[model samples]
Target: MMSITFSGWEAVKDRKNLSANEEPKKGHCYMMYHGTHLQNAKTIISRGFQPSKDGLLGPGVYVSRNIEKAKCYPLTVDKKDKVVFKLQVRVGKVKKINCDNHPMQKTWHQNGFDCAWVPPNSSISSIRSGREEDCVWDPSRISIVDVACCVDPATRKELRRLIQHNNRSGGECDLCHEESDCNPHPVQSCWQCGKTICAFQQKHHCKH
Candidate 1:
């Protein structure tokens, strides 16, 4: 597991002071978090944001204005075991796509454009469908400042307890119902299914 030391958590939180205003400043620095499956947390931290089809604004990174609001996102609330990440983004240049005249009105009606996803693709004209008209921002101008796992003291304790329980109980594999062993046959819970299964059996149990 990634180290969840106090210094690490404090280091990430300290970045918030880079900006003076509560809202995104002239530098376009914003603090956001993506709530997702525990299995995907490491991938997201490494590769940066990937647009998802299930996302409200179609395929794009969705972020809340604040950490508290981010904690309320669907994945976090639905899957109590899901991981939430504190993300730092520095937008070099951004276009306001949330107003009344925005081209992607059909999907943007949700006002998701308020925190829109800027595609990495080069030209607005290159984007197919009516979405091409909405692809007004240049993604290359954006930079991912940092990504960190959000683990509060309470959450850390809960995670530790869960791991300890899994190690001690050697819970039944949700896949084959075989008794799981912690030392050699470690048990891991499926972030989506909420089932405890042998870590090696995850491939057979999870389609995701």
Candidate 2:
């Protein structure tokens, strides 16, 4: 279970381009950002800005087996930006795919020679704000390991307030019979329909 942390938009671009095969240089290992819901804290936490997926990249995260030898360049967009969040990933869970002859490549990229494929169930672990450069282990051929962390108290309070205010009355969840509680803490809100949903029931409410 190797852990690598990257900050700034450059890392973000590298992650996306590596997944898409648009990167000029190909390495044995790559890093990806799977936490999309943390977009609000992207710049603040060094989560990297989301790049447009209009190119050869598919809609999933991809990584190389040999990320230690991977070389990163300076930011082309924002050079002076400081490192924000240290994205920690447990690479032991990654599933390998033959980038050369994977069937999914046909749909992912028009030119099959480019781009990579991400296996199902790939996820992220913890993320922090700091400058920690250490390579703990290699994720190339390791099995999955369990890792968990608690949410911050301030974030929890804020979520609770947001849920209560957005839910209001008559905003019962379509999936679950339970209505918004007096101390509701919604994880997702539908601005189009003005509905608030808890984290557990977000999938049933939104299509995305």
Candidate 3:
């Protein structure tokens, strides 16, 4: 594992000059977290993230600067199955939509803004969690840097599956072993071997 030099969480917390109605400065990069089920995390780690079709903030990837807020996601997945992804995001242009039916709640992206932000507890009707959140319009602007596993002491079955995967795919899983015909379009190309393998087989092909 590589050494981490900066604390993203703390950096965001340190911005004390902004008022409640203000949004974070745009055209800057920050560290953020996205929480999801383990199964979904695996797919994202391999195939890359896809923007949501629709949400409170419209078509974008929802993330939080607060790790605690991120941890309470899906509201359905078990704690042991939850995984939080650490990402580096470039919020190109920002818009603040703090209240319900704020006019720009769902159309911020359609505007010139690249990100929409909701301040904590701004709207009881909209932000039920009373937590700060951000919706990034461009998925390409966000990059997953690391994943924090919530599960510990993996089950015997899970451990066996992981071992088998590592052996077959060289520490890669998910996309690497999927059937070639599953997607008609090319998923991605292998980086290590420079082979044009199916996105589902990139890891497997790279090792071979």
TM-score (all chains, Cα) for each model: 0.39, 0.23, 0.62
* Model 2 stretches with alpha carbons more than 4 Å out: 1-103, 106-117, 120-152, 163-208
Candidate 3: stretches off by over 4 Å? 1-22, 153-208
lDDT of 2 by residue, 1-208 (tens): 3432212111111234233322323222233322223224323222223433432234323222223211121224231221122122333222223333445433533333233333322221111111112221222211111111113555534434543444344445554444432213234455444455444342433343
Judging by lDDT against the true structure, name the best candidate: 3
Model 3 pairs whose backbones collide:
175-200, 176-200
lDDT of 2 at 28: 29
Candidate with the greatest TM-score versus the true structure: 3
lDDT score for candidate 3 against the true structure: 0.66
Superior by lDDT: candidate 1 or candidate 2: 1
Model 1 worst lDDT run, 10 consecutive residues: 4-13
Tell me how far the alpha carbon of residue 174 in candidate 2 is from the true structure, in angstroms, after superposition: 5.8
Candidate 3 lDDT tens digits, 1-208: 3422211111112323344344677766677888887767656655657898999888899998878888988677788888777776778889988888889989987889999998887873856768889999888777665564456545424533543453345333344453221123234444555544443332242344
Model 3 TM:
0.62
Q: What lDDT, from 0 to 1, does candidate 1 have?
A: 0.41
Q: State the displacement of the C-alpha of residue 103, model 1, in Å, after optimal TM-score superposition.
A: 2.5
